[model samples]
Target: MSSPIQRVRTCRDRGSPMMTGRTPRMVAVLGVLACAGCVDRRFIIESNVPNAQVYIDDQPVGAAPSHSSFEYYGNYTVTLVQPGYETLTKRVHVRAPWYAYPPFDFAAEVLWPFHIKDTRRYYFELHEATKTRTDDLLNSAEALRLRGQTLPAPERPALPKVKPGAAPIQPVAPDAQPFPQPGSGGILPPPRQDNPLPDVVPRVGP
Candidate 1:
């Protein structure tokens, strides 16, 4: 009979192949359980003017030379405002990388076991706000006034042309009678004259 220690060693050697076969499966299961994919995306905004306020999609983010994280890729409206500088507005399109698209994204975002970082940077320059001088403004006003004066006045509608030999219109006096007298082609009858009654005799009463 073989020694018990030697028998145990032989059995372990015979089973080593089975252990080896299961090792890869165990590793794969552990990887699926513990590993995950991630994507980190951010953008940096900078301006020629330091400390300029930054606005993204009309919402204020912070001062320029700053950064913020984003989740999706597309057009972004960027605006920068600063004292004594003209406000800067622009549209920025962030294009996705190959790994961020469709089927590739699935692998990069779910199956890949490492974090992927995507970074974008933007820069803008601001122009100084132009100041208007009082003298120049006054000059412009004066020039406009002169030009207006030179323009011909709109001609009054020409009075209706009077035909030749047409009767001239006579102005009526304020106190003139508006109606004609009787027998002067007027419709009203002549006024009636009043007759006086003979003096009544007081002694006639019986």
Candidate 2:
């Protein structure tokens, strides 16, 4: 026969283990639902020339030593321009960190307990543009002019003129003579001795 206090105390003792066992699970669930970890990614672009304008994918970002947030990891086109410096253009590849890769990315992005920052840095050097000398340009132009003067001019054959709606004139050989017209009464030239004409007069009254 247990007293009333003893029975109450025994019940409490039995319930304490259940409450104790559920505390850690409740805490873990609250933690998981309270806040999720996040990943911040950005890139820093720098150049040897100070104040050089920077462009990413043809969109202007700012000057050298500039930075911008990015969402993807891949190839990017970068262009730099400044006064008295040759314009520079190049392709940059942003590689993912070990934690940023598959399986691990899920943990780092959503399940991790802390925020993660991923930064990539890039640097470029620029060279001064070459200056052209007036004397050198003049010398090159003079050499070209002299070469042109020394070369012989090309000769082209003259074309004969034709009247509109008229038949085109045929070309004649240099040694060919014009045929005499029947009404012009012009006599035919004698045959050459090298190619005599055959004599075949028909017999009379036969």
Candidate 3:
């Protein structure tokens, strides 16, 4: 009986020292480091899309970690990509100045068939030449010295000012026939005579 009691006491004594102590010094030390252990971690966000790449400020940030949440703070460029869809590049911000960081919780909702092939033939030189002509017309002041550029125009053409609440001009319908303008030298037609016939007009009329 004495041996069993001795064995139980020895087992209790052999338990972890971390669980055994309740000293003032021990409690103070635990309190100081507890913040590191209990700090709320932010999630590194990622979506399961094929061939997805991430970019920030036109620079790539490799593939996102599939495990745990993304805990980055500050502005970010979030992009999700699949072969069939257009490379969706969106500007995202995950900033929280207070505390370690806020919890990361964001998910991408995938959709299908977002873009068509860039098959439209485009020429940059043609566009550049056209732009040069347009800019030359709009930017005539560039031909002068810096100080002389802002001089008042020699001739100021009078242009009609559009009034507020003006009626909108609409295009004529393609199938519509043009009618003679009312009150413009055309004879004034009589008012439409009300039908004197019965409510149910006879199919065989005399």
Task: Give one digit per residue, the lDDT tens place, for model 3 in 1-206.
Answer: 57988998888878756465657667676555443233233334354452355544565555543223344556656555445445666666655544333232211111111221111111111011134477886677666665586787699899667678996666686554445696777665555557765788669968
* lDDT (10s digit) by residue, model 1, range 1-206: 89999999999999999999999999887577446677899989999999999998988889989798889999999999999999889999999999988899888877787788899999999999887688789999999999999999897888667789998777786543456776788774445437755688567766
Residue 62 miss distance in model 3 (angstroms):
7.8
TM-score of each: 0.51, 0.51, 0.25
Q: Mark the regions of model 3 whose C-alpha exceeds 4 Å error after superposition.
A: 1-28, 35-40, 44-72, 97-206
**Candidate 3 TM-score, true structure as reference:** 0.25
Better of 1 and 2 by lDDT: 2
Question: Which lDDT values do the candidates have, in the order given?
Answer: 0.87, 0.88, 0.47
- Provide the global lDDT of candidate 2 against the true structure: 0.88
In candidate 2 the C-alpha lDDT for residue 17 amounts to 100
Each prediction's RMSD over C-alphas, in Å, is 15.0, 12.9, 25.4
- lDDT at residue 119 of model 2 (Cα atoms): 88
Evaluated at residue 189, the lDDT of candidate 2 is 83
